[model samples]
Target: MENTSTTLTMTRRFDVTAEKVFDAWLNPEMMKKWFFTMEPTNKVTKNDPRVGGSWEIVDHREGKDYRAIGEYIEVDPPSKLVFTFKMPQFSDMEDRISVEIKPVENGCEMTFTQIIVIPHEEGWTEGDIEKAHNEYSSQTEQGWYYMFLGLKQLVETGKVKYPS
Candidate 1:
């Protein structure tokens, strides 16, 4: 059995143009600079910014290599992007991420949301599943929070530092 979780929404305003912000998300070079805050160093990044295109990033940290893969579902340059995201470590679990960028007087407002699904594993009770789901949700939320911070810093200051 598989269960879908509630949508997690995050909003942030960046002091950059909508195109700039959107490009940063799709551009491989820009993303390499600030994709994963915890593992800022990526071994490789392959991004093809177009509908039906795929992207992947491999990160090395603490002597372990983690990889995330995603595909573009919808791409509206400078305005919106929808994608499917998954990390291989999570067995049979995938999520959808939607990003909406709106031009503001100062810069741009980005509304981000991810719809997550947790897969059921054999021998796990209801309580155990819920507990695992909650823990994963919390950690995911925190990771994105910091990743956004890195994105903002990169857009604003033109540089970012990720702990090594």
Candidate 2:
């Protein structure tokens, strides 16, 4: 049995231009401004926005290495990014996680989703898909909620807060 959960979609609407919003995600310097939760706290020490480039991040936690590794399969500046996500201690059931950005009326609409199953070591089984979804729904939603909030604040007001 395998358990799986999907983030379905996390869309954010901003008042800034699509180009600026896009750069917020593609530009390494600009990205570091609001990409993570906030503090510069989690530094994406190594970021390669180009296709096939690898990325790495280190969370200044007690013992957490919040890293993102793997090759970028697709990269369309200010539009789409598809990459495989991995770490030394934990691995996603599905190797890929992708984010698509589209220009909205006055800004950008980002649709983020992940094709993955729960970590096998968590005692997840095939019939636990719904359970997995239910358990992860809140945390996952909150994550994106804060993420968009952080991005919105930074882009609109030049403010950033990490781990909020």
Candidate 3:
């Protein structure tokens, strides 16, 4: 397998305690409200939050199911989380996501990183590879930004209002 990759990092501050913010990530109910907004709704089929535990989110839309699966690599309550993320359609690749929540006055700062490993296709030029990598990073950044906005709204108002 050819090796081509990109890392997307985002930082956000939420007006909530570190524990609260961190809980929102691992809690299945809370994740259902903010994670993966591309679809209309989702079901958290499995949410075992611990080292080696697995989680699966199934997006339900148009009478179809789109699922994403992951395994927890590390879990430090109220502080840090690391996981291996994968989508079945891209079975050849697995990505690693890390989240660090630091306590700050009036709230917390969350640093999120996702390292995506893109398959290097044969016969692709350097320019083609760069373009594809940039596009993937941009889309991932936008998607997570919106999800974080949803998370912020939910944490502040106790309701889900994803940004448009």
TM-score of 3: 0.92
lDDT of 1 by residue, 105-134 (tens): 999999999987776667889798888778
Cα miss at 111, model 1 (Å)?
0.6
Question: Candidate 1 has which clashing residue pairs, if any?
Answer: none
Candidate 2 weakest lDDT stretch, 10 residues: 115-124
Model 3 sits at a Cα RMSD from the real structure of 1.9
Point out the higher-scoring one by TM-score: 1 or 2.
Answer: 1
Q: Is candidate 2 or candidate 3 better by TM-score?
A: 3
TM-score of each candidate? 0.89, 0.77, 0.92
In terms of TM-score, how similar is model 2 to the real structure?
0.77
Between prediction 1 and prediction 2, the one with superior lDDT is: 1
lDDT of 1: 0.84
Superpose all Cα atoms of candidate 1 onto the true structure and report the RMSD in Å to 1 decimal: 2.1
Q: Which of the numbered candidates is closest to the native, going by highest TM-score? A: 3
